[model samples]
Target: MSSEVGTEALTRRGLMLVLSSPSGAGKTTISRALLKEEDNLVMSVSATTRPRRPGEEDGKDYFFVEPVDFNLMINRDELLEHAKVFNHYYGTPRAPVETALSEGRDILFDIDWQGTQQLAQKAGDDLVSIFILPPSTAALEKRLKTRAQDSAEVIAQRMSKASEEISHWREYDYVVVNEDVDHCLAEVKAILKAERLRTRRRAGLIDFVNRLREGY
Candidate 1:
């Protein structure tokens, strides 16, 4: 009698996680912290019509495109999700994200609530969303001013928008109160770990379980 041993293989699958927050809510800081700590995670590069910031790379920080190209992409249905922020259009391209997921790589998204809603419609199963909130509106305003990057007028506008942004917190799958960066990072780590172990993420779990039952 010939018998074959059932080989157990570890396969990776992709995840689409979004981290959204109002200005000065620490979403970008948390995202950087996550990337530094999580070796296997990558940030999704969004395409934008805005000019590149100093020291920002073309593809790393964002896929900088002209207004014409961005409008063309919208017409072609190439964006998975997109939004207009401060009069500039920004969007996540469909092709790169699809390719990354198919190849078993996890992608991180830093977008607003509008984009998150659109993303969920397109990638419901693979999507996990987290929204960050400042300890208080006053604290949020303080943080935004600490950076001193924007003019007083612009800061006022952002402060106004913050209220609207925070109103959508219930729409996210997870809501994180970023009172302390270290503590919040720990919370995010736990969230990711738990989500990674979800049954749906294990595409081969059923077959693997069957093999064990059969003693193969």
Candidate 2:
């Protein structure tokens, strides 16, 4: 068993993990924690027409672009998925994702329900989407208020949108309740580990196993 396990570890592919949540959920925090803990994971930077937020650096938080340029990308079929939220356009570009896949690097997406739908259409087999939910509506609202980043009116609006977003939880392959950040991060990490070991992702495994059986 030990020798077989060692051989299996030598043949595995990386994961394409998508983590999504509503406005005040802890998806971003969990994603960042997972990235910090795992060397093989890379955040898939998204392109958007929205202005950069305070403390956000270009190409780090998002790839900010003009509306016209964003539309050009849409027309060229260059985006894997895109959507308009609060009058701003956000999208996942196709090139970088493919590059990461080819390089055997795990790509993480911090997107919304609509973007996840588009990603499923574009990378159905390779994608493993997980939706994170706050433990309760009260807890979610509390989180929003605690952040203090948005006004009361805005927080109310987000809470409303969160209801609609939560409706799409069943669309994801995995669902996680984020009551604790550390525990949720561990759940996501376990999912990524399992996804990486999936047989479909290890396309060369059969040939390798055959070689092993042949005593070469």
Candidate 3:
């Protein structure tokens, strides 16, 4: 088993990993940790019409564009998926994602359920979707307040929307309840590893098996 595993050439088509969660459920935290630890995995830089934040770099954190330009991209069918949130448009550009997949470099999308649905419609076989759930409603509310980044009114608004966000949980390929950050990260990592090893993803395996049967 060890020898066979070691000798097999690993050649796989990259996957689109979509992680969705309510506002405070730790999807961002898990995404950051995964990118840090996994060499071939990178975050999917989205294009948006929203103004860039103070520290965000163009084409890195996000591609900030005008609303008119965003509409043009949609018209051209250049985006894999797009949605409007808080009156701003955000989308995953198609070209970059296709290039990365051909090179076997996995892209992680930190998007909501609506975006995930669009991606599924466009790239069903290549996508692996996960929905993260909080351990409890009280815990979720506590997390939102603990962040201290939002005003009380905004936090209340998020709490109200969280249930609606979580209602799409049935659409995901996997679901993780984030009771502990480290544990949740580990579970997601495990899922990535297992998915990477799937027979269909590993394209080189067919040739390796053929060679073995021919006694070469």
> Which prediction has the highest TM-score against the true structure?
3
Clashes of each: 0, 0, 0
lDDT of 1 at 84: 89
Which candidate, 2 or 3, has the higher TM-score?
A: 3
lDDT of 2 by residue, 1-216 (tens): 122434554555555788889878887789878989999999888899998889998888889999999999999999999998889998988888887786678898888888889889999788999999899888899888998878989998888899899999999999999998888888888999888888888864776676666764
In model 3, which regions exceed 4 Å deviation? 1-8, 149-151
Candidate 1, after superposition: displacement of residue 192 in Å?
0.9
Whole-model lDDT per candidate: 0.87, 0.86, 0.90
Candidate ranking under TM-score, highest first, comes to 3, 1, 2
Highest lDDT, which number? 3
Q: TM-score each candidate.
A: 0.87, 0.86, 0.91
Which stretches of model 2 miss by more than 4 angstroms?
1-13, 51-60
lDDT of 3 by residue, 1-216 (tens): 222634446777899999999998988889999999999999999999999989999999899999999999999999999988889999999999999988788999988888999999998788999899999998999889999888989998989888899999999999999999999999999999988888888886777776666764
Question: Please, what's the RMSD in Å of model 2?
Answer: 3.2
